[model samples]
Structures are given as structure tokens and as C-alpha cells.
Target: MNGQPFQTPVEYLKGVGTARAEVLKKELGVKTLGDLLQHFPFRHIDRTRFYKIKDVQDDLPYVQVIARVTRKEILGEKHTKRLVAQVQDDTGVMELVWFQGIKWVEKNLTAGKAYILFGKPGSFNGKAQMSHPEFDLYGSEAAQRKGNLTLQPVYSSTEKLKQFTLDSKGIQKLVVGLLDQFAREITENLPLYIVNKFKLMARADAYRNFHFPEDANKLAEARHRLKFEELFLLQLKLLKNKVLHTQKFKGAIFDKVGPFFNEFYAHKLPFELTNAQKRVLKEIRQDTQRGVQMNRLLQGDVGSGKTVVALMSMLIAIDNGFQTCIMAPTEILASQHYQTIKSLVGDGFIEVALLTGSVKTKDRKIIHQKLENGELKILIGTHALIEDKVQYQNLGMVVIDEQHRFGVEQRSKLWRKNVIPPHVLVMTATPIPRTLAMTLYGDLDVSVIDELPAGRKPIKTVHLYESSRLRMFGLMKEEIAKGRQIYIVYPLIQESEKLDLKNLMDGFETISREFPLPQYRISVVYGKIKAEEKEYEMQRFVRGETQIMVATTVIEVGVNVPNASVMIIENAERFGLSQLHQLRGRVGRGAEQSYCILMSKDKLSADGRIRLNTMVKTNNGFEIAETDLQLRGPGNIEGTQQSGLLDLKVSDLTTDQELLMLCRKCVEDIFAVDPQLAAPEHQVLNMAFQDKNAGLSWNKIS
Candidate 1:
């Protein structure tokens, strides 16, 4: 209370002594008055209305009533003991029970005393009851004022905080106390001109209204203002990072699409390129020729030909007399890329080498020698490529496949391979939605290959219950009769008592029994399997020696078998939408019609139903991605949480996409005039940026 109100610690606040303050800091990350003020409520309740005791229904949400305690009794044994009080209003009576804190309830309750009660109504043996309701003596100052009580904010609390009497209501009381003392001291962070243009509420007013709004409209306006502020700051940071990268980093110029690229495109190319692939390749070529380092993301669906675009981009780099490398998250994927690229560049057009951990010591020495001597035009490997012994001579470009699997530090290692850091092109077959791409990878230029190759049929998706297993078996047999292979994927590698999931080994046994291994061979693969054994199983499936492959999600990436026309996922409800999509992508690589059959129990959760229905409705990856974002929120979606891009407090990427876009546009407008924010009009923004981003790790590679 002595220094600035915003900087005062919570321990100094009224009713929040040192012990409670420590709990607040530990549980909710609220240490100071400013932190308490910013901890906005997840939801609010209208306390202006009250329900009669007779009108209390089991389905009704939180309701308040003025009632008198008619009788009180303690029931049940220890650990299950409870204090029950019969409360009655003019209309009727209802039971209020406290299973926890029974001693406190017993000490506080008095028969014939009037009180205001509030909680969700529940039914106990056909009688209306409320468990652990909030109550205060009627006519007391603590009682909520009827008609004068507007919106009451409910804050989130943890179990530890609850042990110290800091539940939602308790936290709300602390927030109210802090706001009452320091409302005037909460200063604005946005510039006046921007605020006036947007007609935004002042920061102080927004915080106050967010904690306890006078009405619903003011609450909405306050939310909009705060969400805009959060998104605006995030966009400003991302845009600044982009400006820093482009202005400071210089890249090698691949000015020519020379003979190596043209010859492969004309003669050695296996098939015609899709329009989407051509468009993405053109974008990459433009970036490489600009002499500014290209930090681009190549997003495509399972079989949309992202690998071809990456290969062509690498060829462009090699044609410029510079070596290039492709980094995969796993050896299987690296080997796949190396073989595909080598085959596409037939007749030794480019000297390509694989440098995975499995490569022999002598082979590693040869790869190192050739790479240093500039004899290796293209190198492909896993994390082994980042080893200290690996050095590149004039490395011009780096292509990272499934880039989210690697950390920022591991990917940054490739940047140091050259004096002027090599141009980066990170690729993912996981189709990221536009909103997600803008926020998560806003610093990178994104190029998407949206179309699949010609004559490739769309994979038909369906949901099946356990009762339809015989039907599913018949379909599998029919597909195998047509010389097509099949994949049976499970959610777990071993049985777990907690989850009734179909494990991989059990699934392999079931399939072997049904298919009879002498007539039909089945290969099993999972993460626990050795690298050599997994590769052997995968090769067996790829070569069509095995008619079926029983595996876990380890086959979700890198395994390519065009002959595998059907993907059957057991316990599909247990898998996420992204994992389901990735697993489905393992099929439909050839001209024949493919299918993804999702097998689950008869019952499903709402989200599970949405995922199954969505897969059945469309083959478009972007649409599926948008739906996934909505269903899972930003944090649970694959890499956003790990990248720290979704470390947002107020703004939601799913519901606030328009606000995010507006904020990005506003940042662009500001930077157009004051690139460094040195002008007087942008001084507030500069100060706010420093305060927000201080000591933050901004090493994410888009």
C-alpha cells in the first residue's frame, strides 16, 4: 500500500494475510495487486434474481433464496458424515447439506435464523437439496443485495487453494478487494489514437467491468477490449520477430532453375505435378531468389504431394551450386524421403546420401567427407544430422519434414551449418487452419499444396461399432481379395486397466486368428520394437509380403504403402482428430479407392461423435482442421501448447479469429509508419511490449 497501487503485493491487501497470499501466488500465479486485477473471471452469475424454495428444480443452475433454518441434524458415520439443515421460505422448505467442513457448518447454523442461500439444486431421494451452498445471515452486510446485485464474477481455483478457503468465491472476494482499492491506478497500455479509433474502453474500466460489470453489454464491451489488447500485443510481437528476421538475415540466392531441375521435371519426373504443388513451388522459388532467408511452412494433407514440392525446392538449391539437407523426425521417414528423392532424380543427376544413426561408422565417415568436399548434393537424416561431427560445405537450404516433432534448439542447429544461415522450409502433412497458422507460424511465409495428384480417389471414411465387427471383417477380406493390403491400428501397445482400449499385440493375435497366417501374413510394429525390427516389419508390409499390418500410431508417419487401401482404427474414439486424420492418411496413396473405417464402442462422447461425423462428411483437410481446432481448443491441438504460441489469457484462437485478424492488420498499419515504434504515438506500445516480452524465450522457428 505504500508504493504504487499496482505494484503492491497481495499480502498487503485487506483480508489476504501472508499465508493466503502465498496460496494465491502458488495456485493462481497472482502475486501482486496488478496480477489479481488481471485474473479475469471464466464466467459470471446474475445475482439480481432469486428463486423461491418451492421452485427449485434439479436441472436448474445456481439459484439464490431467502429462507429460515427450521431444523438441523448431523447424519452418517465418519468420513461420510454430513450436516443437514432444513431451510424454509414462505413458499417451501429444502435441505442444505455440507459433507465437507461439517464442523464449521454445525458451529455456524442456528434454528429459526434467516439466511440467503445460493447453489445448484440437486435431488436427494426425491427431496430438493443443495450441497455445500453459500449462505450469509439475512439483513447482514454480507448478504447479496436483491435487485442491486449485478454480475458476480467467479474465478478459477485449485484444490490446494480450496484447502485454504480460496475457492471460486474466496478468490472473487480477493479480486473485489484489490479492485476496490486500486481501480483508479490500473493504467492504459494502448495508445490514445488507436483507442479512440477503435472506441475501446480504458484499461481501468475494462478491468473493473470484467471483474464486476454493471450490465451484460458493458461486460461484452470490456471482454472485446481486453481480447483485442491481448491479440494486438501477440501480433505485434510476431510481426516484430518477422521484421527482425528479414532485415537481419541474408540467404544464398538460387537465381536459376537450372538443368538439374528442368531435366528432372521433363524426363525423370514420375507423374505430372498438381496445380497446388506448382503454386507452392513457385512461392518457394520466389523466396529463395529474393536473397532474404526463406522461412516458409509447407502444409499439405496426407497425399497432397508436399514431398515433391520439398524435393523441387531442394533441387533449386542444389542447382545454385549449394548443398541441401532434409531433416526428418524419425529414421523411417528420413529413409522414405531419401529413397523417394533419389528415385525421382534418377541416373545420378544429384549425389544424395542418407545420414541416420543406423548408418555404419565407415559410411558416416564417407558422408562427412563427401559433405565437406561438396560431393554430396543432398543429405537426408534424422536428428543424427545435427551432430557436431556433421559439417556442410556451402549448405544453402534446409527442408524439415514433420517439423513440429523437433524442438527449436534442434532445428536451429541446421541454421548454424552455414555462415549465412541456410534458407529454411519446414513441411508438415498436418493441415493447419488459417487462424492457427497465423498465430502459431505468423513469422513464417506459409505455402500450402491443397490438391492431390490426378486420378487419386478421395478416401471414404465411415464409423463402425463393435457389433459390426463381422461386417468389417468381410469388407477387409474383400479388399484383400483384390490384392490390396490392409492396416489395423490400435490406440495402445499394451492393455491398461484404466482404459478398455484394444492393444496392438491383442489386435495382432485376433487378426492372425481370423486371417490364418499360412494363407495371409500379418506384420506387427509399435514404438517399443527395435529400429531394425520395425523397419523389417514395415518393409514386409510395403513389399506386399504381408497382407495386413497390425500397429500402433508409430506407423502414423513415414510408412507409405499404396497397396494398403483400407485403414481400420480400433477404439477410434480414444484417438484425437489429428491422430485419426494422420492414421487415415497412411492409405489412399494409389489410384484405387481407399477407405478409413473408425471402429469403436456403441456409445461415444459428443466430441467423439463430432470427430467421426466430420471425417465421414468431407475429405478436405483444411475443413477438418478448422473443426479440430473448434473441438479441441488451441492448447490441445498438436504443437501450439509446446511452442508457447497459445499462452493466451483472454483471447481464444477458435472463437476470436476475427479479433486476431484485426489486431494483425492494426500491427501492420502501425509498423508501416513506425517500423521500430520510436515515434511518440507508439511509445505506449513500446513500453507495453517491453513489459510483456521481457525475458521471454522467442526462439521458436515459426
Candidate 2:
């Protein structure tokens, strides 16, 4: 069965000697008949019918001719022999030529015999000719064999394989031999209703015909079934992961909001919290109060007041006699969060501490000791928060800003800092689209701060062609003269190994040469710099000592200088829409009028043009996120690899927005009735989920 278990390639199957088998393994990755059977065709050549000799043209690559072999001649040396045969049909006469393989042609073609020759038709002296055309031998039964050619599948071949004469026909022969003993695995994954409703072909038959199809209809059916299965399985795996998290993991619940919230609201902070902010805070308060631990994502647009919400939540943790830690991607962001809350939090009640990798040894020891004891109420730091030495006495909640920038496993390490896993409140300035949020962070409850605080003016976005660079510089000079800071950003820092750096670096040098403001200073930052150096440059800009900051996207997420009112992003076409939006968010932070000028070269792609135009039209981050979802699709929107998010099959979180909504509805219903998918109709989904992820069930920490 299946050709005697395929021990050695040469002895395992027919037609393959040691020499040919070695060549097959080396050149085609075909070590056995099994490999040959699975080597699928990229595309097929349709030969349902052929054109007559008279109808054939040089442009066409195939022609049919009922030609009589009027003459035959052999030429060339033994090593490089050639065969020339002249044939005439009812339409016209043509020469059939062959090189290197003349002996084979000579044995097959007999003079004065009528045969059909199929190949590329060309011209020689105003007459039809074919170079190395495929021919069938004439026999007494040739009359019965005359029929239309059907679609022929084409297999990719290398020169070595071709030299062994392993053409498409040879592959077909191998497939036929293997199929004689074929025992297809029966897959009963999708529900019978789903299969019937979708008009899917039987799984076993689909696999068989997918490799070797008899007709176009069968091939189409096979492809549809396979694609559907691939997508469905992928989605099932991701969704099941979320289900496992919900059922298996236990979290620390801190649901009481009265004590800490009452004190903060009684003070009636200077600025008012928007209605959207109040609603989200309420959701978080309720989730924390629940018996199970709270894992929630607080998604807000740029300048939507997310920091304040996080601070309030941390206060609740502190009031409950537990410690809280806020982690940011960069030291600057962490320090910024600490500074923003230090005054509002009104020190002494909560012993706030900051710890970073660069902290002095003496300071580090004190901070470590304070954190180990219950002396520290609230702690803020970069990755230093997750360090082994920095143990929290009673860590109850963790607030991570720009949460997607982290590895999910790395973030999980912070939860282990406490005896009981801390209630995680992941916050993001990036406005995640609803579809993406449902799939990527499906395990976590989500809250959105959709409204912006009053009196914060929307940034005015504009697009300019590179030709307007000189005028744009003049405008920037005027803005700088008025004591307003400007951000001049290039796509890259230096010349890249692959890309041309002439644009970005050249622009940087030109700016240094041209605009030399005597009173104000300029700071530059990029990827090549060390972390400390980046912090130093950003600090200079933040302190108002530097009015112009020339940087790349390194400052896109971090380095919030509210005083800066002008943002100029060069070669905007080179950046993605989301990135450009993030860069735009850097400005428009303060009360002053902010402008974002996107400069691009001519000839923008349709997608790029839409991205730039959308930026120019909208100021709402949610609207921009929705547009980003529509344009970039789900992969970039949710960032699966980095997010450790669920992989959705058959569902594009963007294009399949309606399907996502439907899936959400189904999730609610299933949880209501059959939480574990144990119902009869859902049995297939349950088994499919169980059968899948068998090997990947290890704890995420490992």
C-alpha cells in the first residue's frame, strides 16, 4: 500500500533510479512518490480546443494541426543532435524542429504519417513554424483519438528536473500511481449545516481533486473548501485561546470605587472629566469590583485624557491598602506620567516613587527597599517596574501606557511581581478600531474614552507637494519667530542599507544650513542614538530651550511637548496612515493653534492619496482609526505577532466588519446558553478547538 512505505527514494517507487532520485531530491524536493503527489500546480493551461494551422498566429503559443509528415531529416553531432520534419495540413505546411533530443523525436515521428503537433506557433519566411512542438504518434486508432483538448495543469519544473524529462506528464504519471492507493483522511470539522449552507464540497474529495482535478468546476470547489477551512481553523484557534483564558485563569478583583473615588472627586479637580471618561471609569470600577480579577483595555484617542483616568484607578488601589505601578515604553513617558500625577495626587498620603534602569545605585537601593515594604503607595517606571529585585509589597493594579508596544509575555511578567496577580489596566493612546479590539484583545474587557476634553482645538492638517518646500520653510520660520516650537520630522535618521537616505539626511543638513535662529535652539533625535542620548535631546526640547526638534518617529509616541504648535512631516507618502496620524497627534496638545503639514513627492498611490486626504479631512481619532481599518486591513491594525492577539480566519477585522458583529452576537448567545460549546450543533467547533492547540497549551510565561 502507498508503494511499500517509501524507504529509499530509488527502491520505493517505479521509474526512479538512484541517479534520478538524487536529482529529484536535490532539484525538486521530491524524495518520494508522496512528495510528487503533493507538489501542486501554481496554475493550469486551458487546452479545451486548439486553433487550426490557418487560424494560428505568432502571438498565440498553442496550435492544432492535422498535418502529414512529408519529410524528415537528422542533423548535428551525436551530443547535440537536431531533428527537422516538414509537415503539411489542409490549412498550411510548417516545419517542426527539435534540438538536443533528436533521437527521441526520430523514434516517435515517422515520415509520411498524419499527426497533431501542439506548441508555440512562430514565423519563418512568412510561413508557420513550431519549435520543439509536442506530437502524438499516428496509429490506426488515431481517428477515434481526435477530440478537443481539455484544461491541462502545469507543474513548475527546474532545469535539472527537465533534463531528467520530468515534465508535467511525468508528474501526472506519479500522481496517478500514488492515487491508486490513496487513503484520504476524513475531516469532520465544520457543522453539517455550515457545509451545506456554504455549498462546500466533501472534504475528502476536495483534497483529492485539489491535487489532481478532472475539471475546472471540481478545482474551484476544492479551492473554496480549502480556503474556507484554513480561515475557519485559524479563527477557531484564536477564539478558543480567549475562552481558555476566561475559564482557567483567576484574577484579583478590586471592585470598590467609593473610598478612593470619593476623595478625588471631592477635591473637584481643576479640569472637568468628559461624559465619555466618566462612563469608562464607571465600567472599570464595576469590573474591578467583580469577584474575578479585572483585565481591561482603556482605549482613547490622542489628547483624550487617558492619563487622568489611569491615575484615578491607581488611587483606588492605594485606598484599598494595595500598591500600584504604571509602566511606560520609554523613561521620558514614565517620568511624564509620574510628573503629571505628582501635583494632582497631592503627595504624603501616597508615597510615590520613580525607578528607571539609569537610577543611581544608592537611589535604587532606597527605592527597592521602599517598594519591598509597604512604604511605596504608587510606583512608575519603564521596564524597571518588572525587574526581579523590585518587588511590590501589595501590588493590586498595573497601568501600562501604549500597551501594544510590549510583548504580551513580557507584560505578564509584571503581574508575577505580586503574590496575587495584579488587576491589569492596559491603556493606549492609539484608537483601536472596534473590530480589531474585539479580536486582538478579546480576553480583556474594553472601555473607550471616545470624547475629547473641551477647549482643546483640533489640529488642522494640510498636504503639500515637494515643490512647495521653500514656501513651507518660510512659513515655519514665521511660526518660529512668534515663539512657537516646530517639529521637523524626516522618515529616517540616516541612509538605510536598503532605502535611499538622500531625502531625509539631505533635508536635515539643508535645515541646519538655512534656518539658524539665534535666540532659539534645535534638537535632533533618531534610532541610532543610545536611550540616554535620546532622553537628553527630548529633554532639551521639552524644557523650551529647543524650539525646533528634528526627529523621526522615535518621538511619535513618547516626548509629549505640549508647547509645540507646528508639525512638519516630510515624505509623508513613505509613512503609513496610522503612523502619520500618530505623528500628527504629537502636536495639537496645547491650547494654541496647531498645524500638521504633510509634504510628499508627486505620483501618490491611490491608497496613499486616500490616507493623506483622510488626514486632511478629519480631526477625530476614532474616525481616523475607522479609516485606517478600512485602508490597511486587520494585520497592521491589531499587530498579531506583537500583540499576541487571536488570529482570525475567514474574517478580516476590517473588510469583514459585519461578520465580526455577527460573531460578537454569536459569542454572547453561546455564552448565555452553551458557555463551553458542548451543545450538539456546536460539537464540531468544540472538537476542532480541542484537537487544535494540543501542542501549544504550555503556560504563556514559558
- Candidates in order have lDDT scores of 0.86, 0.74
Model 1 poorest ten-residue lDDT run? 692-701
> Per-residue lDDT for 12-120 in model 2, tens only?
6666677777877887767755456546666766555656677879998577667899999987777667788899878777888898577788888889888867788
TM-score of each: 0.89, 0.78
Could you give candidate 1's per-residue lDDT for residues 272-305 as a string of tens digits? 9999999998899889888899999999998898
Off by over 4 Å in 1: 1-9, 52-58, 65-148, 493-503, 693-702
Error of 2 at 521 (Å): 2.8
Top candidate, metric TM-score: 1
Give per-residue lDDT, candidate 1, residue 505. 64
